[model samples]
Each structure stands twice: as C-alpha cells, then as structure tokens.
Target: MTTAVDVLVVGAGPTGLTLALQAHDHGARVRIVERRPEAFRPSRALIMHPRTLEVLRPLGVTDALLEQADTAPKATLHLGSRAVEASLADLALPDTAFPHLSLVRQTDVERVLAQALADRGVAVERGTELVAVRDDGYGARAVLRTPKGPEVIRCLFVGGCDGPASTTRACAGIGWHGRPYTEEVVLADLDLSGTPGGSGAQLFAGRRGLLFLFPLGEQATWRLLATRASHGGPGPDFGQPGPPVPRSELQHLLGDAGLDARIERLAWSARVPLQFRLARRFRRGRLFLAGDAAHNYSPATGQGMNAGVQDAVNLGWKLGFAASRPHDSTGGRDAEVLLDSYDGERRPAACRRLFLTHTAFWAEASTGPTPSWLRAAAAARAAPLVPVILQRRRLVAEGVRVISQLRVNYRRSPLSVEETPHLHGAPRPGDRLPDATVGVGGPPQRLHALLARPGVHLLLQRDAAPPPHEVLGPHVTALRVANSPGRGLVAVRPDGHVGFRCGKVDAAGLSGWLSLICATGQPPGRPRPPDDAG
Candidate 1:
C-alpha cells in the first residue's frame, strides 16, 4: 500500500507528536507513525520548564497539562541533615504565563498531546515501523512495515523524532557524537510512609551520594533518583547489567539521606547509563532530526523532553510554509531557504542546552573523595547565604530566568529581520514576544491567545489604525493591543516569535519580509485593491 502527505513524522514521541500538531495546525497534511505498540507506560522525563509551556501554549495543550500537572514553585536542597530552600516564584517571567516547573508523568504528557492530535483528526499510527527512508532533492519516500503488509509513504519533508537510535537519521547518514557518563543511575517511583512539609521537589547530598525525591501528587508517592555512589556499590563498574534494585536497598538509601520515609511499594524502576551526544548535522536534504534523534543530554537538568518539544515547534511552521508554496506564488527556491533555516537555528540552541546539562551533571554527580569533600564544604558555606540571596527579588529573578530557558532567542537566524535601526530596549526580531495582557474592559486576555490562530500576526498598537485588509493579506491576522510597550507594528511568526519589528507599519517591508521567510511571494489570500496612498 502507498500513501502521500505533506509531512511524514517517523516517531510518535512527544517530539514527533508536537511536530504533527503544529504542522497540521498550519494547514500541512501530516501523518505520524510510531514503532511502539502502544503509548509509553513509564514516567520518563518529568519536568516541563516555563519556556516549554510557553511554546506549547499555541498548540492548545497547555491548559490540559496544567490541569494534570503539579507545580513546584520552589526547590529544596538538603545538605547532610540541614535543608535549604530556593524560591522559584521569582521565575514568573515579566511577559509570560507559566512561572514554575510543572511536574507530571511523561505518560500523561504524551496522552494529552495525543488527544490534541486526535481532536485535529490526525491519529498516530501505532505498530507501524519505518524500515527505510530515501530523500531525493524534491521529496522523500519512507517504507514502513505494518500488520497487514509493507506500506510506502511519500512526503515533501520527513522529521526524525525517533529515539537515539533513529532510523530516519541512520537513513539520512547523520553522525551521532559524544560519550556516556561512567556512573550508572537508578530511577524509581515508589510509595513512601513519611511525608515532607512542602510540595516542592527535594534534593539530598550526603557522603553516600545524591538522592532526589519528587512528590508524585499522592499523599506519599514519590519519584526517587540515586547514583551508584549512594548505593554502597563497589566503584562505578557493576560488571553486568543487573535487575532493578531491591526495595530493601532503596529503603536503606532513604534512611542514609536522613529521610524518615519507608518504601511501601515500588511501582517501577530502571537502571540507565546517561550519555551526552549531539548529531553532527540536524538536516540532510528533505529529512531533519529533532529531540533524542538530534541530541541526547544528561537527565540532571531535566531538559531532554522540553528541548525535544521545542525542536518540533521550531521546525513545524517552517515545514508548513515550505509545503504551502503551491497556494502562493513563491517557487521552490524560497522553500529551500525556509527549510535550511531549521538546521541553522535549532542546532545552536541544542548545543547551548547540552553544555548546561553536562556541567550540571558533573557538578552534582562528582564521585572522587576530593570532589565530595569540596562539594560538602561548598554546600555548607553556601547554605547560610541561600536565604539572603533568595530574598533579593532581582537575584532570584535572574537565576530563574537562566534556568527557565525564557531567554533563548534566535536573533542571529536568517529569518529574523531588523529593518528599523536604533530601536532600543524593545523586543528585537527573532525574540519571543513576552506574554502580556491585551484588549480592554470586556475581559483580559493573553497575547498568546491571539497568536494561537493560524498564520502570521500583525500586532498594532491599540490606538493605531489597522492596515487595509488588502495590504496585509488574508494570511495575516491583525489585532489591536492595549498597553503595548512600543508603537508601530510587529510581525509575529506562526511559532509566536517576533519576525519583523518596525517603528511604523511598512506594508511593503512587512510583505517583503514575509516573502523572505514564509515564501509567500505575493500577499496571501485574496489580493487587496490599490489604495490612494499607494
């Protein structure tokens, strides 16, 4: 059997699901396939950072995630027996909605995304495996094995959202580089007897090693992470792959960490070898890699899933624009430029996150005697200053900003255009527009709510007159904003980032910029009649 679509997603994980949703929303015909027979059952990546929440807001899944997730606005670190608290309240970024870490099971996250895709009339084809992919200059073809028989799929673009061992990446000949961490880490979800005071997540550092406990919403259910250093094992080498650690061993480790909790029942457990790796390239012809398929990082920073979702969001709209060329007057040349921008923009972001997670893993998982002693000493010294430092609103805000990834920008990307010179302090092209309250009286609304619609958005100051519909084109949705920081008009991409910002509305310049990035050679939709000014 053979089928055709605008975009063929090779994996149905969070990354692929997100890509499908975004692409579908932008009018691209998308089909997603997953090798897994069913949805993931285990709770893998648990932390959803603020920036990820923002990126997903446009997809209409943020509300569902918020309902099912537990928000941790603060984090507690235990040094020996004493505990230090770090406030995450300051992370409530200036122009955004989400301000804290959302702790939810990875299964639930996937469930919500899958439902959203279903609502859009796209169902993930489970039990379908992509055996091969071939990308010619114009389009790509994928061969899949299904229960019935062999199936072939042809599409203009293919997204490799598969796991670290990605078939799409392998077929594309992209090289994965980097080494694995020497230590073996264990993760488990268990029910506990004793309870902690706050609902926030906790990290314990002791002579034995490091233990991180995250409350699972229930009375005493928690997710625990521990390193071999805390397991009383001999060195890093365990000789062979062993079964899950016994419940008795977990209880002992908890007791050593000064926790009064006792393990009631273990729901799940796994021993994993952490690795830090990135693909040599993210794009090859009509195929591109995202998520674990593109880069793999330590679980310490809890960024693996968030980064992958962002990758899909970044690539979805670009692929949509390229696929929509037939409706517009633009040729394949513009589509090529749009597709190439994906690799140029996303690779650097992944590199930055990889560096952060690597640094954090070593800092927390250092095992040698000297490193242990130094960590203890540093923790003791810093414990006293934590409260004082956290009390300063500015300091706390800055710390949260860095960790939340809200500062990530694509100012250097080819898609970003800054035509107006000397514009100071305002958001530049390629920067995410801060979520702010817009509209007046009737009710308060978020900027993202307006951007949730399909196509580019032209945000005009409340008092400013909107450009003629003919001048702006049907593809552009114009909205009037109240309390907007700056005058003039800002062109926001489908992904919710500022694409072009000008002091005043330049219909010609704005249209030209759109052509450059979106490949809409002529104004989209119905052509506007010539005005007296023109």
Candidate 2:
C-alpha cells in the first residue's frame, strides 16, 4: 500500500498545470508531466472571456493575466458592404469585475500558470508521457514513457489533461464522439497596416466561414483567424494541419474584405482544421479526463482553451478534496459520489457549448441551402437591421454575457442542496453568486476573493454568524456580511460553486453538509489556510 503520489497529471498545458496547482495547494502530493519537450506551443486561441478571468482571479493569477490583456479590444462585424461595431469594453456586465473579453496569447496564459506551478516547487516533468493507466482496487497505476525510458508510477488518482489525442483517455477505454468540419482554419502572425487601432478585431462574415484579424502585442502586430474551403490537398487529414497559408492568398482575402490593408510581413502561419469532439464520459473510476482530453471545441468565440481551463478548475478542487482524505473515510461511498459529480457537471456544459458552436458554424460556415439563404439575408439587411440590433444596450450585454460563459450553472447537481425553499431573487445552491462586497465592520472583501482561497467557505449574514462551538470542517472559512437583507447561510465549494443554501443561519444544516464534503476524523477548522494564502 505504498503510493508514489496523490495525483498524476498527464499533461502540462493550461488544464494540467491548473489541476496540479489546485491539488498541491490543497495539500495533495501532485506530479504533472508533459509529452511536449518544449514548455510552450503555438496556438490559435486568443480571446479570454470575462468568466475565465473571474474564475482564475481566485487562483491569484488574474492580475498577472490582465497585465497581458488588451482591455480595450474592439470588435467590429463586417456584413459585406456595411459594418456594425460593438465595443466589448461597453458590455454592461455589472455583476463581475471583468466586463470585457481580453485579447491575449495562449502562450502568455500557459506561461503564467507554469510559473505559478514552479513557484510552488512543482516543476513539470518535461518529455514525460502517460502511456497506460488502470483503476486498481486500491488506487490507480499509470505507465509513462519518459525521456530516459518507460516507467510505471502508482498514485491514488490519474488525471488525463492531455490534448485531443490523449493516451490517458485511450488507456481508460473512453469513447471520443464527433467529426471534423470541412472548412480550413488558418492561424497566422503578421504585421499589417490600416487596422482601426493596434489592439482589436475586425470580423467578416464570408459565404464560406467567418474571417478575423486581431492585433497581438507580440513580435507580430496582428493575428489572423480566417476560414477557407478545403482543396482536398495531399497532406494532413482532417483535424490536423494541411500546409502553411501562402501570402498571396492572405492578400486576396484582405482585399476582398475591403479592409484596404497591407500585409507588411507574415511571421508565422499554420493551417488547422475546425473540428468538434467530446469524450463519452469524463471519468472511469480513479481515471479522469479533463481539458481537451474530455472535450474538443470548434474555434468559435475562442471557447476552446477557455472551456478547458474551466474544466481544470472544476475537477481540480474535487480531486484535491478526495486526495486529502483517507481510504476508510465514509467506507468510500461518499468520495465516489464527489468524484462522479465532475463528469455529471462538466459533460453537460461541454454538450451545451458544442450545440451552440455547431449552430453558429452551420449558420455561417456550412454550405447548406438554409445557411446560404441566411447569409444572403444578413448581408442584404446589414446597413439598417444590424445597427438597430447593436443599439440596444441590454440586448448587447446579454449576448456578451453568454459569450463570456458567465451564466453557466449546475442547479441539477447532487452537490447542490437548498435547505430553505423560501429563498428568492438570490443565487440558488448550484449557481454562482455574482461578485459582491461582504463583511461586518472590518475591511470589505469581494465575495470572489473569499472563494479564491484554497478550501470550502461558509458565508453568513452578520446576525447569522455561527458560534465557535459549532462544528464546521477542517478547511472551512466563514465570513459574515454586514448588511445582507436576508438572514441566509451559503456554503461555497472549493471551485466557487454554491453547495448549500438556507434561508436561516442554521448551524446544523451547515455542519451536516460539511460532513458530506470535508475529510473526516479531524478537529473542526484545524487546517484553515490564511486569507493571503490564495
């Protein structure tokens, strides 16, 4: 019964790095490995929705991420001869701190997460790859291919944070369901002239697909994400790169869009196929799938990497909680329920996103008759209809919020329980309470700041604060809001989702929920992390 580590993370991308950080911070022995020899890779995902920043804020990386964000990145939609402009900066997302979509490179985000892992004394095992895994009766065993040679490692849990071609997923016998899109997506880095400013995006709706030009604050001034028809070239198959997009082709596209722009230099270019896929299941006993391993999103609204990071955060905290407990805890039944909830919550979220992207791609990229007609109708009414739609502030904000994924919730989850049915107009048990200031008389604190800490949190109205004699949990942090209208109590799980909600400050209800979530056989609040430990 000796184990090498508490958790084995099989990829070093954003998801794996995030999972490794969360598990380790929660007192689990975590080891993250990557097959890629180099720490960074070229990627097409560049937009960070407000929801992404909101979740990462608690992990103490949002400030670093914002440093690299183009906060004022504007988005203009071009419909043939006419254009409709909408500034993300103007989106009225008043519930959260981040109100606009951020324009930043994928590499910058990975760099920040990787550095955070290093700061915690956990270096990613470069050139190490997971080759096989199995859920043994006691724990799990993973066979890996390292630079030196093949090695076998035993750990309590095996996490598959690897990308689309995840060996861990394959090893766990999970099914990958979906197909590749016929259109070609080309990503490029170049220097260009005639952009409105140097830090926004110009979007064009083509008959074939959507085309975009973005300003990247890197060696290249702009990033290109334009779609094209496949020539059936004798090169890579679908879902893989075919060849580099030629400069002549890019020049013609810019001209067709009426940008009157000139390409000064094409620093780098890659052709990627647009595809959508999601694993049949996210978990198999002790083996779990996350990030691209769990699902692959089409390149639309920049959800590919953003969703993966969110998947990491959701699964990371649950794994941390399970790993910190002993084998005999609850005779194993409740821990299994906690682990199972990861798949329960994330799979549906992935399905919802895939449905949205599929509909969008069909309307804009597919060659069907309905899509063709819709495009023609849009182009025909662009001048009059588009401007009127964009003028409605509330409507525009709603669209922005949907794109930012701020409304994702898990109300149906078993982990979400409402003890009091009278509560209304506030976030329910599975919904994220919008960020607000909370405290009694001391310095006011942001609700998200409290959630960002490493463990479960209990938020109570000032008059509802539990007495010291009450048994909370080993890792619980309690906060009392000074003037909450309703004398309610809420328990927020580690990943910032509300786990329990009650109309009254019922200590018994909070204690019962703690027994369901916390590690057993420990003093109440024995291992609470400090406020600044986030």
Candidate 3:
C-alpha cells in the first residue's frame, strides 16, 4: 500500500528520533523508519555538552536525561606526577540552567526520546528500509521495504539522519568528502575496583598515547577510551578487521596511566577508525540531510552524538515551518528558502566542530617523541599554575564558554535579520539568547522554559506592549517579560537562536520576516498573547 506523510525520516537514531519528535511537536505529520529491528543496546556518545542540554530543554527530555545521567563539573588530566584540572561547571555560564557536562548512555537518551514520540502517538516503524527516493520538484516519494512487502511513501520532504553511510545522501547525490585518521581508538565499558583517581572524567597522557576514563554514575563502573599506542605497541589496524579488545589489554593501559583500578568485567568493546567528513550540501530538492549524514568527526571531544542532536534541533523547526505551508500557495517558494538556509547555518558550524575535534585528537594522540615530550613538558610547567588558573574566575569562565559551544553564532546566515543598534548587551541576530531568570520573585524561571511553546518566540521587554496577534501569525508566540536587559523585542527561533532583534517592537518587520519564513495559505488567526505574569 502507498502511504503518505509530511516528513519521512530515514533513520531512528538520536538524530532521527529528535527530528521526528520536533517535527511532530510543530504539528507536522512525521513518519520515522529504522532499518534495525530494535534500538541499540550498547551505550555510546556518553557526554552531553551544556549547549546541547540548553537546546534540548524545550523538548521535555532534558530533565529526564539529567535524572539518568551523571554530571562532571571538573576534568582532571594526569601527566606523570603533575595533575591539572579544568572546571566544567557553569561558573562562566550563569545564564544557562544547565552549566555542566552530562554523562548519559546513548541508549538511555534514545529511550527517552522514543518514549516521548510514543506519547505523541508516533512509533518508529522498525525493519522498514528505504530502498530508493525520487524528488519531482514538488515533493518526494520513497520506496521502503517493510517486513510485509515493499511500500511507497509520498512525502513533502525526506530527512536523512541515517548516519555516515546515508542512503538519502547518496540518493540526493551529495558527496561525503573527507579522510579517515591513521590511528585507531578502542572504547570499552569496565567495572573498576574503586573510584579511578577522581569523581569526574580523567585523562592520562604520556609518551605512549592518551587514555580517558569516564565514570558512568554507578559505583566502580566506568568507560575507558584509549589510543592504539596506549594499548601497548601499535594495536590492530581499525581500518581492517580486528578481534575483540581483551580484558588484559584494558588493565595494562590503566596501569600504564598510573591507575590501580582492576577491570572486574569487560562489558563491551569496539575498535573505531576516526574520520572527519562533511557533506558538500545539506539539501537537494525536497531532501535534507542532518546529523552524521551531514557531518562526521572524531569522537575525541565526545561531540559526535551531541552535534547530531543539535543538527536535528536546527533542522526540525525549519522542516516544521516548511511542512506547515500549503502546497498550492506561494508557500512552496518560501519553504524552499527556509530549507536552503539550513545548509548555510549548520554546515559552517559542523565544519568548525570538525576542526576543533581533529585538533584535539592530534594534540593528545600524537605518538612522536618530540611532540609527546613537548606536551609532557608543558603539562609539567603548567601544573603549579593550575590552582591559580582555577581560582581566576574569568579564565575558567572563558574556557567553559569556548568548550561548551555557547560561543557558536550564525551571524553569517542569510536568515539572520538584524536591525538597529542595541543599547543593552542583548545578543544579536544569529546569537543564542542567553538564558536568564525571567520572572518576578515567585521562583526564577528560565528564558528557555518560556519558549516551551512551539514556533518563533517573540520576547517583548517589560515596558513593551504585545503586538497585534494577527501580524505575528499562528506560528509565532509573543511573551511579555518582566525583566529584560534590552528594552526591545527579540525573536527567538525554534532552535533558540535570535532570528530578529530591534530596540523597539516592529510589527511590520516581524510580519515581513514571518511572511517570508512562515508563509501559509490560512489567514492570520486570533492573537494568543501570553499571560502578563510571564
């Protein structure tokens, strides 16, 4: 039988699941399919950065993930006898509600996201594989092979969140252009004898290679990641076939790092050949690519899954806006423009992250004697200054800001419309609106919490009156704030970035921007102004 949906998601991993959930939340009919019959059982992508937590706040899963995850406020690095720790706490990010790194299994994250989708009446169609896709200008049709038989799905758009080997990307003729690293990395989950060094994640660097130990919340349970050289001599080539990493190998690496923890059990292990690749284009016709399908980077910084999730967050609302438009009206053109903006904004961000991860990997993975000696010497020289650096609040804050990805901006995006100079230190168009306490005495509420509602959020300063509802359209929500640093209005996009900012509320400007991005066939509905208490 031939079925139809507004959006057909090609994969059901974290990226695809997030896209499906957000698309459904935005009132789009989304159907997600996974080739795998069941969800992954093993845990991967353990760290959820602060920015990811903030972006996920509106999805209602952040709290659930926090409940199941562990927070690492400090990361300690041990080089010989010298130990330096970098604080991951939010001493720098006072505006954000979540200012620390969250350590949660990827399986748990998928479970939470999948349950949220189930609550919304959408279940992932397992064992449904996309065989082919064809775009005929207006919409796309996908050929899927289900357990029963082959079924055709006609949809307005196709989201390719199918990981590195993306069928959607190949069908769209997008090129995955990059190279893989020469060295291999082995990751394993281990049951340790006791606390390994400290509560937070620990890095042990030496002339051999680098080893990382991350606590998995439970007592004595930890995740270990080490370079091939760190496992004693050049380990098996990950590019070629390899055997399972033995438990003794893990123990030896731990011992080499000065850790005395005994491996009670080797729960799981895998050898991964790192790669840094990005798609040439994110969109082709009615097809869109996101997550690992769009870009793949080294996992050294633990950014692969987080970047993929953020990719979904960035593309989800855009897809929702496009799908909300009527097919017969001029909405098609506006939707195309909105969809095209995805590449402009997300590609650069992915490239930046890829560069950061690659640099970080080589910085710690280089096995050359000269580079290793230099790193060790630097660590030795800086050990005494670690206390002073941690004490200086400004330095620690700056470091946190960079690594947390709070500094990412899309000012170069064509969709970012900025006008008028700001008197207050409010964020500019394309910058993420810093989360802050938004309510009066009755317990502080976060800015993101106010944006739980779908669509573009128009945040009006305390003195500013709400604009006529008809001008903003149904997809736009206006919230009058009691305390705003800026005496103007800021239009926060679905992804939490500022879309439009002005010193005063410009209904005409807002309407123009909305008309371009959120064009629809229906007439403007009645204004649903938020309560004054907001």
Evaluated with lDDT, which candidate comes out highest? 3
Question: Per-residue lDDT of 1-534 in model 1, one digit per residue for the tens?
Answer: 366799999888889999999888876899999988898655668788888888888788999998888764567878755688776653536677776767777778899999999998999999999999999766998899987788887899999999888899999999999887776577788888766544478887765567888776232378788765433433322212235778887888787767887787888675666678899999999999999999988777788888899899989988877777754345566677778888888899889988898887777776777657655667766777767876787766665566667777888887888766324555898888888776633577777766776677777664445565545554566776666644577778877788887777666777677776655535347633311110
The ten-residue window of minimal lDDT in model 1 covers 233-242
Distance (Å) between predicted and true CA of 39, model 1?
Answer: 1.2
lDDT of 2 by residue, 1-534 (tens): 234898999988788888898788776799999988996556556888888887777678889988987887777777766677767775677778887778888888889999988898999899987877899977898888899898888998988988888888998899999987776677778887756432357887766566788766355877787776655556554445558888988887677555677889888776877668889999998999998888886676678888888888888878877877656757367678788999999999999999987777777667666776666556756556877877777788798777767788999998888886345655788887688876656577777765776777777655564624445556777776665765677778877788889878666766667756765334434544223211
Q: lDDT by residue for model 3 over 1-534, one digit each (tens)?
A: 476788999999899999998788776899999998988645657788888888877788888888888764567878678777776655756878776767788888998999999999999999999999989886898999999999987998999998888899999999989987765677777787777565478888766568888776223367787875433344443222235687877788788777777887777776666667889999998899998889887777788788888889888888887877776656767777788888888898888888888888787776776657755666667778778877888777666667667888889876688666452567888998888878733666877777866677888887775776667667777787776644588888888888888787776776767766676225446556755663
Q: Compared to the true structure, candidate 2 yields what TM-score? A: 0.92
Q: Choose 2 or 3, whichever is better by lDDT.
A: 3
Which numbered prediction scores highest in TM-score against the true structure?
A: 2
Which structure is stronger by TM-score: 1 or 3? 3
The parts of candidate 2 lying over 4 Å away from their true place are: 1-3, 193-199, 217-219, 233-242, 329-331, 420-425, 443-445, 465-470, 520-534
* Full-model lDDT for every candidate: 0.76, 0.77, 0.78
Give the per-residue Cα lDDT of candidate 2 at 39.
66
Segments in model 1 whose C-alpha atoms lie over 4 Å from true places: 72-74, 86-92, 196-199, 217-220, 229-243, 327-330, 421-425, 439-445, 462-465, 468-474, 482-487, 521-534
What value does the lDDT take at residue 346 in candidate 1? 86
Weakest lDDT window of 10 consecutive positions for candidate 2: 525-534
Residue 71 CA error for candidate 2 (Å)?
A: 1.7
